[model samples]
Target: MELTNIGTVRDILGRHGFNFSKGLGQNFIINPDICPKIAENGNAKKGYGVLEIGTGIGVLTKELALRADRVAAVEIDTRLLPILDETLADFDNVKIYNEDVMKADLRGIIEKEFAGLRCAVCANLPYYITSPVIMLLLESRLPIDSITVMVQKEAAQRLCAAVGTRESGAITVGVNYYGTVKQLFGVSRGSFMPSPNVDSAVIRIDLNKKSELTEEQEKFFFRVVKAGFSQRRKTMANSIASLMGIGKSAVYSVLSELGLPEAARIEQLSMEQLMKFSVMLMEQTKE
Candidate 1:
């Protein structure tokens, strides 16, 4: 059955006496085309393992299980287990766990279930937990090859935003350090049951093996980026001075050495420029 067949989903939930919980973000995708697109973009073929979050009504999970060798879907709402079991019965490869994705030990789960197979993450993420969930997957010790998620349109733009753009912020810079991000396509509000107030977009994050900096350097660079965006209206120097407890004169000196104007805002610096500024800050501290 395709995801667009909402009647089936409704029937299954009705049988189990399940009520959609607003807190869990229980919006079900009723667009069959989106299922295949998400699976294809995630590159989840046979022999690959997939970690799925927020598997509401098993619409997307059914599709993922068909494509991937093994699919582990973590759902915080235990009430939906029977419903998922009924909907996803034929797929022996699918495993449903009743736990919060944030609290689960992903490394242990992957090691025990997936073993040596390449892994990808797929989700129709809740708007509230989207940022933390994506960050958790990217920062995990597991071998996550890629991530394809459906998030609110605004959130998607922020994730794929380029440095020096209005949308760029700490999350944008942080994601860029780990991988390449792209907005795949947008989904209309009407495509989902109990439709969201806003539209959503699908995004892909391809992990990178070679980082330009050592672990320490990457950490320091992000620290600076976070501090830079801590006060959006303040100049970059003022923001860094306030966050890092450094003098405004010293911050300006570092910006001058990097050939950036003294009045430049934090939004004006790219990830590369941020790293260079971090190095200059270290040198100044040493002097």
Candidate 2:
């Protein structure tokens, strides 16, 4: 079955009574070249199991199944279950779970489904939930090797942005804290059946096996980061003081100790600076 064929796709969807849901951000990829690349770069191979977040008529899901040892997809839209069944009927290695990826027991699923095989994640993510989903996958410390996803081009820039740069956001820091991200490729807006307004890009995040901070310190670091970026225009000292309920003087003192100007904005602080600043501020909080 040519999943990307407009006639085939329409017939399949029509037969299954499927209608695109804007609220769900349903944009099925019609580009034949994209899914194979996503599957390959995602590390879907003989010894690897692939966990897919969304099954858009089993398009990418089918590609992952062809390459990976096992393919498990968590799709929130139950309306696509019957469609997926028809689409993916030939693939015994693919399992479909009708559950929200955010709320699903991903760790449990990985353990049960992948067993001895190494695991990776591949998805054509909905633009609205991109950051939250990526953060969840990273923060949960899943045993997956890498996450390859297609997101809005603008979001791709933010996600893969350098932590201390203007394009960076809280998500950039959060993502970099857990993994190394790289933009893979770009896909035009016209690549989908119901094309999105914005172009999209594929990016990969290779999980870091080692964490620089302990559990307590890690939590504190994120807390400080959240506060730092809450008001991007404000100086880091001011933003941190305001959102974290710490005195501005104390924040200024920390900044001075770290050799950062009191006027330094959060975007201007490097990752090393942020780490040092977070630790020092955490110590002061305990005092």
The candidate that wins on lDDT is 2
TM-score, each model?
0.94, 0.98
In candidate 1, position 101 carries an lDDT of 89
Predicted candidate 1 versus true structure: per-residue lDDT over 1-287, tens digit per residue = 55468787777777788887888877889878898899989978887999998898888888888899999888999888887777788899888889988999888878777876889999999999998898888766468889999999999999999977889887788688788999999999988998989999999999975677777776777678888887977898788888888788888898888889999898888878887888778668768
Per-prediction backbone clash count: 0, 0
Q: lDDT tens digits, residues 1-287, model 2?
A: 99998899999999988899999999999999999999989999999999999999999999999999999999999999999989999999998989999999999999999999999999999999998999899999989899999999999999889989999999999888888999999999999989899999999999965889989999999988888788999998788878888898888899999888999998888889999988988888899
Candidate number with greatest TM-score: 2
Candidate 1 versus the native: TM-score?
0.94
- lDDT (0 to 1) per candidate: 0.85, 0.92
User: Per-residue lDDT for 213 in model 2?
Assistant: 91
- Cα error, residue 194 of model 2, in Å, equals 0.4
| TM-score, candidate number 2 | 0.98
Give the CA lDDT, 0 to 100, for residue 237 in model 1. 79
Looking at model 2, the pairs that clash are none
